[model samples]
Target: MPQPATGPTEANTFPALCAHTHLFPGARCRLQGLSDPHAFTAAPWSIGVDLRFSDDAAAAAELRTGGPDGPVLAVPPYTTGAGTRIGERAWFVREFTWVDGEVELRIGGHA
Candidate 1:
């Protein structure tokens, strides 16, 4: 497993991670409910992540707290499988939904 990035200052680029895997720039992970993976870019100041969990229990646990728009959920620090570290400050759950045993979560973050 790759170690988490210490700070944004340590690197010039920060990529997105899903299930501890790196989604290389312009690459998207195929999930049930999401047509495109949530993406982050500094050039235009955009950030978002879309995750699909097949494990019902895990998905339920993630949504046990506030409602979809109630509270902001912080994304835990994680390094991609390729050894890249995502050092963003905060990422909150923007949307949550379940379908056919799959839980889809839409998360967003600030620049």
Candidate 2:
């Protein structure tokens, strides 16, 4: 008989896109780069991110028509040998610029 699925299986895994932004899977956006991927501090932090979308025109239009609230990006929790630990963090988009089919977002939040 087949054994039960282990941790972090692809079958139950989802992309790291921010669901709160609603510009993730629906917009075919993929994370391209992050200014600071690993930062451990409580002080206010700001990071720059680059996102590439399959449909540039549509993505730009969506961003323009977004609600008053900015997009929320998060880092999901994970499990380690010690135990499951919360690594979740939320960052609000301070501003975003789209140029040459690339979306650059400046996000800030408490880390």
Candidate 3:
């Protein structure tokens, strides 16, 4: 995920791209640039990724410190058998109302 410039810079917004979509909360998301296969625990878990969001503020703040402070990116949640056709790669949504300007995601699958 790329950060927006504080001064004069290029515009990076996804207005026309993600025109029609539901920006649902509590979705599963994965951050990029940090992967560790050997950092395993007793049970199978996500590697260098966060899988859930919450309405609770304290719980969300606790989870934020679990990883390094890079540009957090996520894959938008999808329903089962919804036929949403998400492609192998897609751009992460750079702005949203929730999460204090973190780069949340919108689904933009290729045809």
Candidate 4:
């Protein structure tokens, strides 16, 4: 994981982690109601997410099935130059283990 920011605004934590891990945080990354999005200031890829369908179980199922259609939850591999957007595409639940309400995402991207 990247070092915790000295101060909130002093660091771009998401970009730093993506740079190190080459992966993004997905919808389950949320620890609260909603979080500000992230982008790579410089890197090889970017990620995007659409939470409009988060409340829709059908959408979630489609995402889990890797369907090409449905809510675009965890889109990935955006060019590094792509500008920052409202959400960050992230790892699937399979990448990490969730026990009870706790998550063990060892590769970072927790925003």
For all predicted structures, in order, the TM-scores are 0.35, 0.31, 0.20, 0.20
Regions more than 4 Å wrong, model 1: 1-64, 67-69
C-alpha lDDT score of every prediction, in listed order: 0.31, 0.32, 0.25, 0.26
Off by over 4 Å in 3: 1-80, 96-111
List model 1 lDDT by residue over 34-60, tens digit each: 222232111111223333222211111
Residue 111 in candidate 3, Cα distance off native in Å? 16
- Weakest 10 consecutive residues, lDDT, candidate 3? 56-65
Candidate 4 per-residue lDDT, tens place, 1-111, comes to 232233233422221112221333442332111122221111111122222223221111112223333122243333233232333453343333333332222223432
lDDT of 3 by residue, 9-50 (tens): 322211111212322333323322222212211111222233
Among all windows of 10 consecutive residues in model 4, the one with the lowest summed lDDT is: 37-46
lDDT of 2 at 73: 51
Rank ordering of all candidates by TM-score, starting from the highest: 1, 2, 3, 4
Residue-wise C-alpha lDDT for candidate 2, range 37-110, written one tens digit per residue: 12101111222223222322111111211234545554344333334343544445454444333334455552
